[model samples]
Target: MAENIVQRLRDEIENGIVTNQFAPGDRLDEMQLAKHFGVSRTPIREALMQLGAIGLIEMRPRRGAVVVEPGPHRIYEMFEVMAELEGMAGSLAARRHTDTDRTGLLAAHARCEHSANADDADTYYYDNELFHHAIYTASHSSFLIEQCTALHRRLRPYRRLQLRVRNRMKTSFSEHGGIVEAILSGEAELARTLLRQHIAVQGDRFSDLVATLSQREAHSG
Candidate 1:
């Protein structure tokens, strides 16, 4: 029962943050949240700690917990590193993937395509995440897989928002095809390059994110 309360509180807080109900820098009052949810402060504290671990909140001495949204610059820096990590994963996958990995990757890709064709961005986002994780596992490096998954969680909200951009799903699916082809053909360099581009935040996609952030900030302000 306590564990369930913690999970429920965590999801509530996460949903509030992602939906802009709790703006960046907004302080989270434990007492108020506990009262609102008819729970004890223990679960609220645990939920906040979990959110902090995922980069969605900051916990400070005396100041309590505050929501945090990574600024554009920070997000770009993260994506820059993500591109390199993804590139390495792609190159390694091309060389190291087993038949089992190929089967999983292809299955994940098909699911992503299905979601995209249905124009279900939410479903596509989740499927897209599975597809990326499949590539990460294909790398056959436990440490690399852990690192990629952590960063992926940290960037989850932004990545989900990016899918809402017009026609972005179709474009992302096409890029997935290129990546799949390169990895399957064992073209390490091509796989690396394609994955890097696929993960990197730039061009119109970057612009779209900036606009979205600006609008959210404006509304929050």
Candidate 2:
């Protein structure tokens, strides 16, 4: 029961931060949050600690927990590293994936397609995580999978926010189709290239992300 409360608080807090309800640098008061959620302080503290672990918040001495404001440059750098890691994973999966891996990947891809066709960005975002996880598992390198998973979690909110851009879900689903074909056909280089392009934040996509953040900040302000 306590654990459930903590999980709920964590999700609620995370959603609040991602949606800009709790803007960057905003203090997260334990007592106030406990009152707002109608839970004990213990769960609020636990949730803040979890958020801190994932780079969403900072626990500072004397100041308590505050939301972390990720700069555009920092976000771009993170995506650059993420793209390389995912590309490597794609390459390995193209070469090493087993029958079971193939089946899982296809199933995940189909789920993503369904969500995309329905124009449900929220559902597609969840399905997108599974789709990427399927590729990471197919890579068959435990170390690479661990690294990819960690970075993916750290970037979760930003990635989810990106899906709200016009037609992004459909475009992402289309890219997944190409990636699926490349991996299944054992085209390692092609898979690597395609995955890198799909994950990298650049060009118009980068502009779109910055614009969206600006709009959110304007509204929140």
Candidate 3:
């Protein structure tokens, strides 16, 4: 029951952060969260710690917990590293994936397609995560999978923000198709390049994120 409460609280807080209900720099009061969720402060504390681990929140002595949304430069740097990590995963996946891995990738992509068709960014974000994890698993390296998954979770809110941009979901779905084709064709270089481009925050996408973050900061201020 305690584990259940922790998960529930964690999900609620994550959803709140991703949806910008809990904006950057907004302090999270444990007592208020506990009261709002009808739970004890124990679970609320656990949830905040988990969020902190994933880079969504910062827990400071005396200051409590607050949102830690990255600024434009920091976000770009993170995305640059993310692109390289994903590129490595895609390259290995193209070279080492089994037919079973291909099947799993296709299945994950189908879910993403379903979510995109429905115009549900939240659901698409969930399925989009699955799609990327499928790629990492197909890389056939336990360490690589663990690393990629960790970074992916850490960047969840920003990635979720990207999907909220106009028609970004559709574009993302199409990019996924290119990546899948490259992987299935066993074109390692192509797969790596495509995945890098697919994940990188560049051009108009970076601008979109900048505008979004600026607006969020203004609202929070």
Instruction: Identify the candidate with maximal lDDT.
Output: 2
Regions of model 1 farther than 4 Å from truth: 1-21, 30-47, 201-207, 215-221
lDDT of 3 by residue, 111-150 (tens): 9999999999989988999999999999999998888988
Q: Would you list the C-alpha lDDT of every candidate in the order shown? A: 0.87, 0.88, 0.87
**Candidate scoring better on TM-score of 1 and 2:** 2
Model 2 residue-pair collision total? 0
Score candidate 3 by lDDT: 0.87
What does the lDDT read for residue 156 in candidate 1? 72
The candidate 2 region of ten consecutive residues with least summed lDDT is: 201-210
- Please identify model 3 stretches exceeding 4 Å from their true place: 1-26, 37-43, 202-207, 213-221
CA-only RMSD, every prediction: 3.3, 2.5, 2.9
Query: Is candidate 1 or 2 superior in lDDT?
Result: 2
Per-residue alpha-carbon lDDT of model 2 for 67-174, expressed as tens digits?
995776787788899999999999999999999999999999999999999999878988999999999999999999999999988877678778877877889999
Residue 167 CA error for candidate 3 (Å)? 0.3
Residue pairs in clash, model 2: none
Better of 1 and 3 by TM-score: 3
